[model samples]
Target: MTHKIAILGASGYTGAELVRLIATHPSMEIVALAANSKAGMAYEDVFPHLRHLALPDLVKIEEIDFDNVDLVFCGLPHATSQSVIKALPKSVKVVDLSADFRLRDPEEYVKWYGGQHDALECQAEAVYGLTEFYRDDIKNARLVAGTGCNAATGQYALRPLIEAGVIDLDQIILDLKCAVSGAGRSLKENLLHAELSEGYHPYAIGGTHRHLGEFDQEFSAIAGRPVKVQFTPHLVPANRGILATVYVQGDAQAIYDTLQKTYADETFIQVLPFGKVPSTRHVRGSNFCHIGVSGDRIEGRAIVTAALDNLTKGSSGQALQNANLMLGEEENAGLMLAPCFP
Candidate 1:
C-alpha cells in the first residue's frame, strides 16, 4: 500500500532531503510539493542535483489538495508550522521539521522561540520525534515534532549515560560543530565562501542556543531531575553533518557499555569501538549516527562523541523514520542507504 505524501517548504535543504530519500521509497509517493516563496518553479530549478527525479513542481501550500496526502512533511521555518499545521486536515499525519512544536511546555516554546504557540491543541498532542527514544509514542501519533539537529546529535551521545546514571549530570558539557547547511538554504554574509571556507567559530555560547531547551527538557525528564547541560554550537565550513563532543564525569567503559546496549537493536545508530572516535565525514549524507567513547586524560572523566548528517539523521531522515512508525511501515524502510564516505 503506497502512501501519498506532500512536502511543505519543499525548496529548503531539509525539504529537498526528504524528496531525495523518498524518491526511492517502496511504499511512499510524493503527490505535492509546496514552497510558497518559490511557487510555480520546477523543483529541479531550485535544487539542480535532484533534477533526475521527476518531482512535483513547487506550489503554494494553499494550492495543495490535502485530501490526497496521507502525510505532510512540514519543513517550514520556525514559528511558521504552527499556523499552517493548525489548518491542515485532521486525517493527514504530520511530521513537522520546524521548532514550533518541539518544546512540550507552551511557556518554554515562547521563551526560546520568542512567541506564544498559535497551535496549542496540536502542540499538546504532538509526540517528540527522537525516533529511538520516542518510538512507541511516534507509532501512535498524528503529529510528531522533529528535533533540532544539534539537539539530536547531543542527545544520542548523552541520553544513555543520563538514564543509566553513568555520568555526573551537573558536570555535563556539550560542544558541537555543525555544518552550514543546518542553517538552511538562506544566504548570509558569514556563510559566503570568502568568509566561511577558512574559519569556524562558535555561536549560541554560554547556554544561549535554542537547542538547550530540548536538552533541558529531554535530559531532565530522563534523569528525573533538572539536568542542565552546558551546550555551545559552532558553525563549520562544511555543507553537511554535526559532530557533538560531550564531556562527562563517568566511568569510560561503563558509558561505552551503556550506549552500546541502548543502541544494540537500533538500525540507524552505530556505537563505535571504545577508545575510538567518530567523524562527520563517516556519516555524511546518511541516516546513520556514529558514536564513540574514550577516557579523558583526567581521571573520572570521559568524552563521548557523536556524528551524523544534520540534514539526514538530525532532521529529514529522522522525520521519515518517525513517519514510518506512524504509518505502520517497517521503521527502516527508505532509510537504509549507506553513508556517503570519502
Candidate 2:
C-alpha cells in the first residue's frame, strides 16, 4: 500500500531530509511540497542535491489538498505548527516535527514556549513520537509529535538507566554538543562560515534551554516525581549529528548492562562496548543512535554518551518511523539506510 505524503516547510533542513529518505522508499509517494516563501519554485531548485529525483513544485500551505495526502509531515517551526496542523483535515494522519505538540500539558507549553497552545484539542490527541519508548501509542495516534533532537539524544543515553532504577535521579546531568544543521537552514550571523568554522561554543546555559521542558516532562513522568537534570547545549561547527555526554551517579557496569540488554533487540539503537565511546561522525546521516557507557575514575559515577544524526534519527527519520506505524507499514520502512561516512 503506497501512502501519499505531503511535506510542509519543504525548504528547511528537516523537510529536505524527509524528501531524501522518502525518495528511496518504495511505498511512500511525495505528493506535495509546501514552503510559503519558496512556493511556486521547483523543489529541486530549492535543494539541488535532490535534482535527480522528480518532485512537485513547492506551494503555499493553502495550495495543498490534504484530502489526497494520506500523511503530512509538519516540519514547520515551533509556534507555527499548532495552528497549521489544527486546520488540516482530521482524516490525514500527521507527524509534527515541532515543539508545539510535544508537551502534553498546554500550560507547560506556555511555560517553556511562552504562549498558550492554539490547538489544544489537537495537542491533546497528539502522541509523543519517541518511537522506541512510545511505539504503541504512535501506532494508534492520529498526530505524533517528534522529539527535540537534543532531547532524543539525551534520553537515549539516560532513559534505560532511569527505567532500571540503577542511577541516582537527583544527580543526573546532560551535556550535549550538536551540529549547526540542527539550528535549521535559517541564516544567523553566528552560523556564518567565518564565525563558526574554527571554534565551538555553548549556548542555552544555566537550564534556560527550551528542550529542558521535554526532559522535565518525560523524565518526571518516568520517575513519578520531578526529575530535573542540569542541561547545557553547545553548537559545534558541523553539518549533522548530536553527542550527549550524560553524567549520573551509578555503577558503570550496571549502567552499561541495562542499556545493552534493553536495546539489544531494538533495530536502530546500538549500545557500544563498555568503556568505549561513540562518535557523532559514525552515525551521521543515518537513523541509528549509538550509546556508550564508561566508569568514572571517581567512585560511584558513570558517563553515558550517545550520538545520532540530529536531522535524521532526531527529526525527519523519527517522523518517518512514527508515520510508518500510523499507516500500518513496517516501522523501519524508508529508514534503514546506513550512515554516511567520509
Task: Return the top candidate by lDDT.
Answer: 1
- Write candidate 1's Cα lDDT for 98-213 as tens digits: 99999999999888988888999999999999999999999999999999999999999998899999999999889999999999898889889999998899998777789989
lDDT of 2 by residue, 3-92 (tens): 999999999999999999998887999999999998999987899999999899999999898899999999999889999999999899
Candidate 2 residue 24 C-alpha distance from true site, Å: 1.2
Give per-residue lDDT, candidate 2, residue 17.
Answer: 97
Error of 2 at 20 (Å): 0.4
Task: Give residue 298's lDDT in candidate 1 (0 to 100).
Answer: 99
Provide the TM-score for each candidate, comma-separated.
0.99, 0.99
Clashing pairs in 2: none
